[model samples]
Target chain A: MSAREISRLVVPNRGQSVWLVLLSASAMAFLAVFALALSVTSAQLARNWSAALAQTATVRISAPPEEIEAQTAIVLEVLRTTPGIAEANVMVAAEQAALLEAWLGPDLPLDALPLPRLIELTETEEGPDRQGLRLRLAAEAPGAVFDDHTRWRRPLAEAAGRLRAFALVSLGLIGGVTAAIVVLASSAALASNGQVIRVLRLVGARDRFIALAFVRRISSRAFIGAAAGTALGMLALRALPEAGGNVHLLSGLGFSGAGWLLPLAIPPLAMVLAWAASMATAFKLLREVT
Target chain B: MIAFEDVAHDYGGGPLFREVSVRLEPGSFHFLTGPSGAGKSTFLKLCYGELLPSFGVVRLMDRDVRTLSRDALAETRERIGVVHQDCQFLDHLSVEQNVGLPLTATGRPLREADLSDLLGWVGLGEQAEALPPTLSGGERQRAALARAIIAAPNVLLADEPTGNLDWEMSQRLMMLMIELNRMGTAVLIATHDLQLIRFAKAQVNARVMRIAGRRLQIAGADL
Candidate 1:
């Protein structure tokens, strides 16, 4: 047989450490897949929330019932003449009632409640100058209030950003824990296989040869385990409920078309982690020998 | 070749042996005999560079052992074969793999024909597929010998290679060593078996040395 083949076969394959590394890598990879999915999904949500709200505003007019129609007409005229306003239309009674149905209930009494008339505005890509639009509205119509939804957009964007950051942090933690587990498993394997080291050293085996034996075995095990974990994680993600047009955050917690390829990288990354950890541990343990 | 120049070794309490100077030239056969706890095995260890002399320089392959780096020491050891007293083997591996270790461990390709002939020569051809734990005492010693010489080292150091074997088995192992020495490999065997030493001396011109009084003494020709 070849030397490399023999060196690889020297270390006995049966031990507690083998299973320890396999299971730890699998669990870590599984968690990593979740973190990756979260990050990807949150990034999509952040972009969607920011873009959806960025170029839109709403003007709510509150006046006596007799002046409501007059103020609403004046607000529509002012918005039409505005520089960045792309489209402006008064929200219909049914549309207004539908918006309120979530909070109040079905068949909202639009006539009974003294609700203000709401004018929805969609701006061009450049967006209307909110300060100037507000000044014009205050002068033209005393009851007309122009709101660019800046208050709502800022907080939603920040929340999505924080969620993405949290997912990244989780990924880093998973990698660190995987490395630690691999190192511990490697150390235990070396310590328990003292006889193997002695026999190999007695046969004039170099440290590199001996280290590669353990590193190859341990890292390959990690790769196999992580692959299985990643597969299961992808299946779980695919099983999640699909998010249609609804902007619910947790509804679509999985990858879309191209995003499915991202989780495939996790298993190879785990293999690399195991390789580095076990190689370092093996060299350190061999140095302590002769 | 291994040479010791005024080497003294102490295990931190005091000197186990001191003022020892010896040289094992190529093709020379030497038997080291001493009672238990007389530092015979320690002397063998020094010869193979497993332990450094505390008070003197020990050289292997014409270089100071202390100056050689860890990897360099391993490379030096590839040229010197050692059969430990306990007949250590990787118990998980079969006898054939254990015998082929010196060549394979050193990154040298092992030929099947050569390994088969060597195993047959050592009377272990039938036990090649067996594990170390399943082998008899004599078989283990033979396997250890086969592993030590698989790389064709310049020198072979055996510490009690025949310590646990019967008279016939000991003679058989000694004859193998004698044959290897005839092939120009220096042989050094450390044991308390005087009869084995006498037997080896009859077959070949061998020098017998005794370790006593914390020193190495060349025995007279009476035995």
Candidate 2:
């Protein structure tokens, strides 16, 4: 077929169906992009939490006011002298008060609050094993209790890991749905154009030529639709406010780093979908006719 | 050329015909005349590779019909043109577009003026852009003829070329057929009109073949 002839069929008849596909694809792209963003964000957060808690330990000492300062100093001295000890600092009164502000209101009078003396322990690159350090800390600083942030960090990291897994699962489902929709649309077109096939066949056209007409028509439309959809999705992502900005909740949903490259694939993916769908539909219909 | 030897055919165990043998030579015209139910259409279909014989072989252009691939058969069909009585068409297309269908289908370059020329030969140049639904019976027959020969096929098989035309109209169509024969295109027309055959015999060396009792024989003696 000539360029004029190809345009005559592909351009005119695609009004409603192409619109439907574009609308569906845009919606799917929006969800799909968000799903990928969430997956990456969750994995990043999980990794950050895991690494931060792996080496650090906090010792909270509770004693009489006269002995509290001395006990904290003793704990810091023991940590600094220990093997794999990088540095140890006795947390000041103000530092302890700032830490309490997260749990209680900052305006609360420190005189009225029974806060413990806080001591920070940092490990070197050759950090001591957490199990061995815990035993040593208990023996040297009997009044001191160590908190590795393990109790809080484990569940938080696990939840983020699961969320990333869930987003990946959702992406898989979207891809499956996209393939299924294209197949159905292609099959319907084949059924409606039955006479076109017969006429072409009678005039010495092989099945490949007839199938190519349909494939070219559908694949180009799908490519256009998906490109438009991906553009819209990227635009929506751009319109979104940054994290810690006015729209605090939605800010976490944008692509980062190499993630922006994923949306660029939608158009080609849709082209493949059209080719697979139309070819399968054409050959299946041909079997019925011949 | 098409040859069928000891060909047997049956339509679902009904109206079976056996041991039918015949040969169609190049540049020769044949008329398949018989009663309405004598498998005349079936015989025509077999000659054109539409139906396969039950027991024997059918050779269209020297190749076994059963062994021809779909594309090969499609290429074979390009050499053979068939015009059914109904003259079905895409109603959305104009008369000229309908006539140039064979050219478009086979990837031939379509000339705009050639469409008008074909319509002119059929006396339908004035109705070039008219849709098929608007054409009269005589006009549709002419359009069908224009469609059949647009690709200049070697064989033209028309089933009832003038079934609904008046005496004058039938003569017009017959003249066109005779003109095509003169141009070395073999024509096979199937009809029950004995009068049309008599009119055709005057202009050319035509032969009358009767299809009766599930057999074929030449019979111009009665006329």
Candidate 3:
């Protein structure tokens, strides 16, 4: 009865307070995986959606006003007739103006700046043959140049991949740190209860009974800590402002639908770690005194 | 039952006790009287398997003290009850819980009423839930006695069980030990109180042992 009661009294009153352990575990859990969550999802979105951007190429025809319309028509015709080219559309003046406005100042008059004629090409299911398409376009409209967005996409995707890897490494480091802290906490608790153990032995308590008290206490404390940390982590993620180029990537980091329940697992998993570590430490330290 | 065989003990290579041997039988009481630093407590520690003899085999309940595992040692302790001169109580626990410690520790479930009745037997009915630190000297001794017999251990070992108690309280404590011996519990009292030893002999057959120069010897006295 006293053993069971001692288990009840472990964190909140007796040794390391429950709130402190819970808070510490929660902090560790949140920090451990936060970077990983961001990196992995960002990498996934980048890898999965990059093909959509890569499927089609755009042509810009730069020439005099009279020749601009002529070159644009010629580029569109080349794209439509080329093998692996499914569709083509010469950009309307309004679409070109909007695209330019994103880079240039919004107040710039589109008529004042003699912007180039742009033609968008769609690749067939078989995919566009880049060399053939480029040759055809150059022969038809010498002023037309193809842009496949090579320089931008490669670096972006590579950066996303690196971020994911970094996140995973961070998660692993956090786990190691958590284990270290738990080991220290368990050891301290075992030390503090040294006299209690001696008394228990004097009263004829088996080592197993004495060990259970510590294992249960530390485990329950870790569980509480992880739960609070996870809750706060979710809350902080939800409160962040999402207005950037990778808004979808940033916001999409968290679980959705059935995946939302996955985050709830961290507490029990942490408890398991605590139980194992504390149980082992308790028994080992108990071997000396009892 | 305990047997000490040519036991020699040393701390930092300085002898606390050496070449000592004693066999204490069932239903017997031994008073190990000595001045301070005479190894009375050391001899008691050896008897209960709290400390192993450095040179000899000390056996409790027919098992080598040093050979037993932690759990085995715990089970061995179930057959022994030790009360310190200070009556080392877990001050946070109530008087009843303190007395019931041995039972709880050994996983021997005790009924609430029985626990209450045991406290009543010790005449601490009013202080049953009171903390050990708050108990008077006599109450602490009685509580210690209650704890010693709560599991009905075969051997009861006390280091000056009534050193803090007044004369009448000491008499009551001695009477309790004699009663336990009458019921076949081998009781060993380590104290310098000759009066208590003399009082013990009047009720039950007791043997007197003395500690001098780190050795224990049976004394030539009425006890």
Candidate 4:
């Protein structure tokens, strides 16, 4: 049958199950948007952290105040001579003081506190061998410790990866729940309109024709609901207070540039899901009726 | 054409009818009469592929109903129109849409002129906009008839087509069936109305068959 004609066969207000489907679709879309944003942001954070920290190391020189400058020079010399170390520079005293000011009060006298000297090292792509660097530092500057940031970077990167995994899993669960709701609602609609289906079949309506009527109705509803939910989700994300300068995770939790198009895909995906669920339900019910 | 070869059906409550065989040829008119619960509806269902024969074969247009795929069966059904006693309809649709349902179902574009003509033919021209729930029993029956013939099927099966109509309406409906038969459309009407059978016998060359004793037999010299 023509879609228009077949559509007219179902009473528009016959069942409330469609509302259940709409509600479920909207809820799923809302959750899915957030999940998608979380996953994308977490992945970006992990990538940034890995890239920024993977080829760098730090050298801390703690010695008697009289020997600090000499040890710092020794650490720099060792790093510059290393095969994979690209550059090494001692941090300025003011920079070291600023780093310690957060722990001590800003008014403290920095130079009198016997602060350790810090050296920043930039390594080549094939970075320095940590064991060799540590042995060299221990002999030449007994107080020097070589830290490649693995202890800190590993945990932060792992945490971001876990968050990304969790968000993806949430998205999958939301999709599954949406599909389940659509199937249940479609089955209820089929049962409620059992007589309509029977009449259509009696008039020689093919299964495709009957299923088209239902699939179109359901999928359209899902699309509308998902579109609304996605819009609201985007707005909610927009309304969040701007992240503070250091809160990279919060700043990365929403889309930018082409990433805005990702949420738009949710509505169409919802329609496809609803279409499949409704078609399967209609054909199965029609089979049972016959 | 519909043919039954020793067809039998059971509802798991033991067989309702067994070893029943019949064939409906093109341009033929048949009256199936039987007592209540004697499998008249069951027989019609088997003829239309709504129910499969438990022990034998029922074929529509030379294809065994059992072997026809769901789509094939649907295609076959488009050529065979059926009218139930209940005059089932999508209650939300207007009478006009219900009457033109066959064409709609077959994906044929509905012609306003043809629908007007068919409704006028069934005496429902004025009631075309009425919903099924608002229709009288006789009006419903005429609408059902109009729906059954909208596609101009090769075979028309009506189960108690005039069961809910007055005598005059019943006669009017029967005349329409006879006209369809004369136009080379095979007709099958299952009814217990002896008077309607008598009325039909006088207007057309029709065979009256009775379902009794778990068998189908042509009643000789009955009317």
Candidate 5:
């Protein structure tokens, strides 16, 4: 039908559960935004952690204060001479104290503690062979232990990957729930308007024609409600404190730059979902009644 | 053009009508009359493809009704107009919109002048902006008639169009049907109102059929 003509046959909205559809769509969109944000942020964190830690290793030398300098120099010599070692440097006392402050508080007496001297190692593209490096450090620099940080970093990266997956699964569940709610609401609407459908059919209205009236009504509502929810979600995300200097998961639970555009698509997707739900329900009901 | 070939319809309990053979040719006018609960409405439904015959084939526009798909059935319905006994309407809509629904369904453009003329002809011009529920019994029937013929269907099937109207209103409705038939549109009206049938026969050469004892038969010149 012509747009003007179809507009005249407004689906009767009285007593139909339209509010349920709107509320469900809004709630779904709201949760979808957060899920998307969480997924994006976790993905970024996983990438960053994996990239930063993959090509780096640490050497800790523990010995008497008089022997610490000699052991550190010997560990650096061994690392520098290694085949896959790109660069190796001994960390200054101040740098070691700053790293230790995060764990032992700022007021700890660094002078009296028997701290281990640290050597940072950067690997080439082929990376340092862990087995060879460990054997070399044990033979030449017995006081030094090679640490790849994989014992803890790998688990952290895996946890970030799992969080991203969980967020994606939550998003899918939200979409499925939204569709189910819309189906129920549209079915209720079709049932309540049984007489109206009969009249339309009697006047030679096709099933598609009758279905368009209802689909348009419900999809428009979903679009409006989803738009509102998306806007609110974006605002809520924007109001959160910036990640700043923190290195934790909760601090990174937000979007940045082009990532904001992802949530903008929710409204249109909700509109399409609502249209399909209403169209299917309307045609099914019309078939039984006509 | 609607044709029934020894069609039989049953409601699972028993057969409501059997061996009902009839043909509605182009430009013909027919009146279906019978006593209460004699399956007049069922016969009308069969003619409009609303109910499938249980035993034999029914043809609409020369195609067997059984083979017509859902979309095909809808397309066939566009060529036929039906009015029910109670005059069903989307009560939320105004009378003007309700009358123009056929054009809307068929995707035909609405012309203000044509709609105004049709409403004026049905004597519902004054109630054009009023809702269907706000209209009187006669006005609702007239509006229903206006909607039925808005697309200019080849055949019109109305079940008890005057069942709820007064004597004056019944005559008025019959006159509208006669006017439509005079314009070469086939009309089949199912009703028990013999007086209305007699009034229509005076204005048009109408064939009268009656359903009795679960069968349909052409009525003689008794009335």
Candidate 6:
């Protein structure tokens, strides 16, 4: 029969099972969209954190008040002669006080505290070897210590990677649950419409024809439900707080630019999943009953 | 198109019928008469490949029913139409769609002119748009008959086709079957209504078989 005619043979199924499939698919798709967004956002955060923290180091010199300026000059001279060092500048006393303002209260007595002098270093694309730079600093300036910030960068990147992994796992679980729900609904539809099936079989309908009849109905429902859920999810993400400098993880959990197109694939994927689940379920039931 | 060779069905209990051999030739008409629970329905089911025999073989369209795959069995059934006791139908579909299902379900085009003529032949022209649930007993029976012969099957098997209709309706349906038989389609009607059988025998060459004591026997001239 023509596809249009085959679709016209849609059995009148129970309303409860229909709603079960639609609601479950919608709920699962909504969750999947959120997981997708979180995965994308966390990946972006990880890249940003790694890129900003890499190729930078700090030099701290602890010496007598009279010798602090001389050591700073020596460190700058050594850094300029280094092959991969792009620039080196000693941090002013005011910049050091602002860095400590978050931990120590504002307006601290910097001169009385005898704080260490700090020098900031920016490296070229091919950064200086850490061991070579440390050796040279120690020989030229005895009290100078080179800190490359690897200890701080590793932990932040690891956390973002874990978050992205968790989000991906969540998306997989949602897909599995959606497929299970569709299978249950298909079984219920086939079981409840026994009379319709008998009539169709009596008229010489192949199992394939009967299976297609139910598959089309179920997959279309899943597609529509997933579409609506995806739309709602995108809207919810759009309403979230915007990402900016110093944004926390949860505050900026959304997609930007071309990333919005990713969630649109969810509805089609859900439709294909529902089709496969319902087709398998229908054929199984037809075989058992026959 | 259907042949039974020493067929027997057990159905988990003792055998309902055994050693029944018969063949439905082209352009032949048959009536099966027996008491309640005498395996009349089972015999009809076996004709359409619905049930496999326990002891012997049943062949449809010259192919063994046991060896045919599910798809092959369905293809065999397309050449053999059947009407049930309750006249099953897809309640969601209209009377016309249900009538034309044999053609449409098999991927054949259902010509509107032929469907209208067939519906009118069965006297259901006015109720073409109605649903099966709204149809009366006689209308349902006529609709079922229309669906059966819509594909122009080689053999037509019916079980208790007129059990719920009045005498006039039964005779009307019997006439349609006789006309179909005249057009070279084999007809088999399983019913305990002996009067209907006698009525059919007068107009066409119909053989009457009775299931008694778990065996099929040709009835004598008692009727």
The top-ranked prediction according to DockQ is: 1
Report the interface RMSD that candidate 5 achieves against the true structure, in angstroms: 2.3
- Candidate 5 per-residue lDDT over residues A76-185, each given as its tens digit: 78887889889988888899999989999999999898888888888899988899889998998788999988986889788998999999999999888988888888
Which RMSD does model 6 reach against the true structure?
A: 1.5
Q: Given candidate 2, what's the lDDT at residue B42?
A: 85
For candidate 2, give the lDDT of residue B27. Answer: 80
Model 1, residue B7: displacement in angstroms?
1.9
Cα shift from native, residue A151, model 6 (Å): 1.2
Stretches off by above 4 angstroms in model 4 are: A1-13, A83-87, A107-112, A123-131, A244-247, A250-252
Residues A1-290 of candidate 2 have per-residue lDDT tens digits of 34236323422264355555556666666677677767767777777677777677777887787887677777777776678877777788788888878988789898677778777777787875667767776777677787878898989888888988998998888777777766676676667766666556655566666777777777777778778777877788778777752212257566666878978887788778768876887777776675
> lDDT tens digits, residues A155-222, model 1?
98889999999999999999999999999999998988888888888888889988988998899999
Quick one: ranking by DockQ, best first?
1, 6, 5, 4, 3, 2
Judging by DockQ, tell me the better candidate of 2 and 6. 6
Q: DockQ, in order, for the candidates?
A: 0.81, 0.36, 0.46, 0.61, 0.63, 0.68
User: How would the candidate models be sorted by TM-score, starting from the highest?
Assistant: 6, 1, 5, 4, 3, 2
- B4-40: candidate 6 lDDT, tens digit per residue: 9999999989999999999989889999989999999
Instruction: Point out the higher-scoring one by lDDT: 1 or 3.
Output: 1
Candidate 5: pairs in clash: none
lDDT of 5 by residue, B120-157 (tens): 99999899999998888989899999998988899999
- State in Å the error of residue A57, model 5: 1.9
Model 6 chain A poorest 10 in a row by lDDT: A1-10
Q: What are the per-residue Cα lDDT tens digits for candidate 6 across A1-290?
A: 35356555657745566788788888888898899988998898888888887978899999998998899889899899899889888888789999988899886676689889998989899999889989999999998999998988999999999999999999989999999999999998888888878988899889998888888888988998999899899999989888776445788888887999999999999999999999999999999977
Chain A TM-scores of each predicted structure, in the order given, are 0.95, 0.85, 0.80, 0.91, 0.91, 0.94
lDDT comparing candidate 6 with the true structure: 0.90
Instruction: List per-prediction Cα lDDT, in the order shown.
Output: 0.90, 0.76, 0.78, 0.87, 0.86, 0.90
Give TM-scores for every candidate, taking all chains together and pairing residue i with residue i. Answer: 0.96, 0.81, 0.85, 0.94, 0.95, 0.97
Worst 10-residue lDDT window for candidate 5 chain A reads A1-10
Pairs with backbone N, CA or C atoms under 3 Å apart (clashes), candidate 6? A1-B107
